[model samples]
Target: MAIKKDMLVEKYIEALESGTIPWEKGWTTTRLHNPITGTTYTGINRIWLTFASYLKGYKDSRWFTFNEISNEKKFHPGEKWHLKKGAEGVEIKKKSIYYNEVEDKWYNSKQYYKKLATLNDVEKEIFKDECKVIGDGKGSYYIFNADEIEGIASEQIIEVDSMTVEKMQTIIENMGVGYEEVMQDKSFYSPELDAVITPPKERFKDEAAYFKTLLHELSHATGHANRLNRDLSGEPGSMSYAKEELRADIGAAFLMADFGLEFDESHVQNHLAYIQSWAEVLKNDKNVLLEAVKDAEMINDYILEMSKERQLTLTQTMEYSALDINEYHVELHGCDEGIDYTVFDNTYRSVDGGIIELNAEDTLLMNDFVEFIANERLNIDFTNYECKKADYEELMEKVETMCLLDEEYARSFNVDQMGYYVSEIFDNGEVVLDAHEDYRMFFTKDEAEMLSKELPMSHVTDNSEFVEILKSNIVNGLQTQSEVNEIYKKPDIEVLKNLKIDKPQINKTMTFGRGR
Candidate 1:
């Protein structure tokens, strides 16, 4: 019989759990071999997963490769594959499969699959015959059918090299542009005709130091009038202008990477040092390093795209709007503009209606906003609060306080008489109230009787305005009865009650007793 999609997915998940994946070799390092370069590298399971996700046929689901062995094999079987090298019609042999001891199954190697040529041998043959070389020299390049490289290699090529100070001076002279080096306090300047880049003379003590500075400046030039058309000629420190400076800095990193100049540990250290020094002045976020890396990668892609094509054009322009409000305007709306302002922790929204959009700037902003709102409206410091107590009274008190519960309800729990009740609380007042052992709390008479006629929480909200509501409803002013009914409504309440405490007696004497 053919396996269903859901079944296949379940099987894959089970394989993952069993450690059948070769990459999950307990604590041992995963060995990855690049068939083309004959280079071996070591990584963990997580890294292997990332590589597997980029393979050919498995692009949609990286869990399995095109060369995966059958499940019937029971044991993981290794496979060998040939990878073609550039220009040399030779295929290099490499191991592309291995058995996962944990999962007790065979899986393909992620690294080997990712390195496979995006184009088959036939596609390469077609491109080679249609394209021709153009320029000469280290930075010189060629022209090829755009269709061949459109989705193949990088969308663009970027050439980066260093030039001597004299060479730079000559280029400026030939362009007939006047320039001047700014004072020690200055960093960038733009003349009426062209922007002039002047390296701080004292900042660099040697030619290597000076060249690095010049390269950074030249990268900025690539974003000039006819190229990126970025208005970097504006006065310094303006919002738009400051953003341009950041873009230039990112551009410089892209250029450095393109030059094959290894950004070794020292280079990274120096860059980080500069970033740290500007942290205060630039209002740099210490946590934004990853975001900065992503921005740098985007800039690199753009630069490479420019290099690949002799001419470039942008087909469409997108516009965005930001609304500004004064205190009077905000008051007129009768809404606190900043009250609900929270950065969404995850901005990538799913198309399904389950996801809610928040007004936060970023994850950190959302976190701060959440805390701020909790403190202001809930009168609780969520950040400093902990749910470590196992006593029902202590846990309930904290929960009630954090959730803005009234005094009567908050004080109902008796720590000395019962064990702890602790679990997560949903925003809509639903709670997973788990009680610990050593607790002795019983429902009132009314609650026990109401339990027999209780409805599912979903049914209660099906026709009412209180969808997903969890508020208590009193019948005959009997609190115990209401509590017992609510407890019974919980799917796991019986199991939890059995584990933590004995069931209360249902005899008339106990049910009608005082303090019931």
Candidate 2:
């Protein structure tokens, strides 16, 4: 059925007026499935069915049509089937049975016979000294709750556990999102601790429903500090909170689609109302809907990266993330300047409009780099040697001189108190300690210079003498007395070894030569 936005809004308003608050009702049906086919509803149909059950106060979650209650046999010339009082006939489809001449055996045809639904209910009536059979019937078909049916074997209709459910459980565990089963009725992700909590799986309608809820919480966990770093701070009923919830809901939907899992009735109903809340909050802005979709896509992509079985698609790699990540124009090696070489985060849009994607690790590294520059946070690596802020200018000069004087100065230049180390010494001389997760360290000259130029360099050393000394030393080992004296005029090796420096300064600069 076509559902109108206005109708949904009306229902929502009515619920509020009556103090029902549909979204806050949790789930009306503890179990939701068709009694006959055992197929769970999905999408809007699921939502509608849940709402129907809630309004009618249906106790049994199982539902069946009139035809479903009947046996597979049809009437024959001598059949003794009888219709019972208030029994009904509903038109339904059944596979046609016929003889295949070539096969010489009866075969079920692909076509179905539209059979009229009928029921056989027998009863005996005693009148003084005789018995009589009586019954009443109708020509209508309707869905009835399981409670309305008789002679139903509860054990026979129980749902069987499937292999898909087992795989889903494994997938959830592999996603690396912390999950714990709690006794509470609600499921949520705690951002401060970067963990997800949910009620026991048995509490859901089925395993599929359990995974659906888990996926939602996992999506929310993506916004934690070490992940996407999404801004999730908002009052519970505020627009921002609704938007975050919307993001998680849409993300969970995407994940379900990818995993080929169907949404249960309660999930569909709850999500629809959840989305409606966001729509109301955004005043039905079309742009916000698009933004929400993009956010969902990014969250799914981020989650998919953890799975070794699935990789991101081209669109996900090049598309903008929901976070504050923007495309930056980069110069490619052999591409024209005006081409579409816009680098968005780690992935780049090639000149031919194709995406050059990077793995998750590379993408995260680039993200940290961009965040470091954008946030203007102090990020430094000191794997080579420790140095003080007061001696930064002098250290730069010495490093430059060392790089010029000896090409391999960085290798054997581990002088305890003095001397320069050459630039070719350390191949990977930088390390980002655990305490400094915000930034990376670089030991290479080109990388260090680029970092210094891009980041806040107020405390960085840019001594011109260092550059001149490097140039002069590169051309010839001979340096003018004044230049040499200027380089040596700063704190000598003895003073550096004796002087005490702050930890922040030591973290700020990487020293070369001996005075570490």
Candidate 3:
């Protein structure tokens, strides 16, 4: 299936409704990768796969296609395996893009454009054919996690020592951002003071909680006057406020993953409540969460960039993180007031959306905006093309759609991840609540004839939602209960090495949850 641009937002909506906020989940710092090749998944793949791993209790980080296992057997000549009887798989969009012969590497189309925009016209001309991506180069494929199959040895996970977590503290301390230990009960980053104020570490329930708070406040500091310069003027409960909160939560998650520390579960309850408050904005604005994640990743880029002392300890997914200018003469159009920065400014950034557009009218009003961008040591490319707001917006849409771009998953778990399930034979039915508590908790739902899979604590095997959807559809004389059964699809699994699995074909149904 073609992935929707709002795919992540749709998943977030379901997660919010289910009281299991996906972004709030704590994750390992290790980027998701194939243990077979030792190569990492980049961009959206990392974000989505991390969530998928969480959703299912796949403790082992290794995941691969059926073909990978098959190819391995050829080398070993003895070890044979198959996906555990009825084990499902997940699909990630895999696209082949043009090779940048100039760099002797590959980048997605947009990344190529930004890299090219930095060079002079001569350099740009040489890359016209060398760095283009075709629209037909995109498609989806299936892969099973190590936990999903048998006969394959799992990847051995090295337990990160205390020194690993301590590195986060050191990195944050060396960031040069202002800090204050308050006697007050609360902790926060003050934009007005350009400082992070938190209670002493002793005030927190655990060391992890204190660090999590620091990561969050520091995320806010990325918006400071001298840093990313994000607008922090929104009153609480406003859309801007909600977006900022979402951005901080996501940024903390990114940092947590890189540091390999699980988010302290102590604050999960409070964070869930906070997530509840933003439900309206998260539910209504499909693009807000996506925007927030992009912003959060940028926050991570800044914090990591500034903390080079411990850079060796942290890993970065540089595919979309680093900046290299290429020829653009690109532009964000001027309105009656010239440069509708409110819209075009953000849209102009090619890197992790640096604050190049920010602090311009404030700190650099006297300085040339273009010159400041030209001189700033930031991580993105810009030729400053003068396109209208409509044109700019359209261009972004096309780039994202054509390139399969943006904050980016795997999973053939049969349910729509709608937070429903069953618990053996209950008087209420064959399904019941699994008491989903936190994002980090994992469990199994006996999917004998229902959802036959191991799921996270967030998933209760309650089939009532499906039944309700089935009843509503049938009552309306549109779809039947049996038809709703097929809503959760079995994937079309194609092996990467051209080894396709002959899995049973499941008939289609009118999908009940998650919109396109």
Residue-pair clashes per candidate, as listed? Answer: 18, 5, 29
Against the hidden reference, what TM-scores do the models get?
0.24, 0.34, 0.50
Question: What is candidate 2's CA lDDT for residue 219?
Answer: 87
- The most accurate candidate by TM-score is 3
Write the residue-wise lDDT of candidate 3 on 312-352 in tens digits: 21112111111112322223322333332212223232432
lDDT of 2: 0.45
Candidate 2 C-alpha lDDT tens digits along 346-420:
122222223334443333233333343344432323223211112233333443444444443223223211122
User: What do the candidate models score in CA lDDT, each in turn?
Assistant: 0.32, 0.45, 0.53
What would the per-residue lDDT of candidate 1 be over residues 1-516, giving only the tens digit for each residue? 222223323333343344332111111111223222344432222223222322111221112211221221332333332222221111112334544342234434432222122334574355334433222111311111112111222222223443445655644443334466665633343534456556466765565555445545544554454443344554544544444545455545444434433333333333442332334323444223222323333344444443332211111121111111110000000112222221111111111111122333322223343344455543544555321112233223333332442233332232211222223334654333322211222333333234223422221111111111222222112244346435433343333353222235223222332112
lDDT (C-alpha) at residue 83 in model 2: 34
Candidate 1's C-alpha lDDT?
0.32
RMSD of 3: 29.2
Question: lDDT: which candidate is best?
Answer: 3
Q: lDDT for model 3, on a 0 to 1 scale?
A: 0.53
Best first by lDDT, ranked = 3, 2, 1
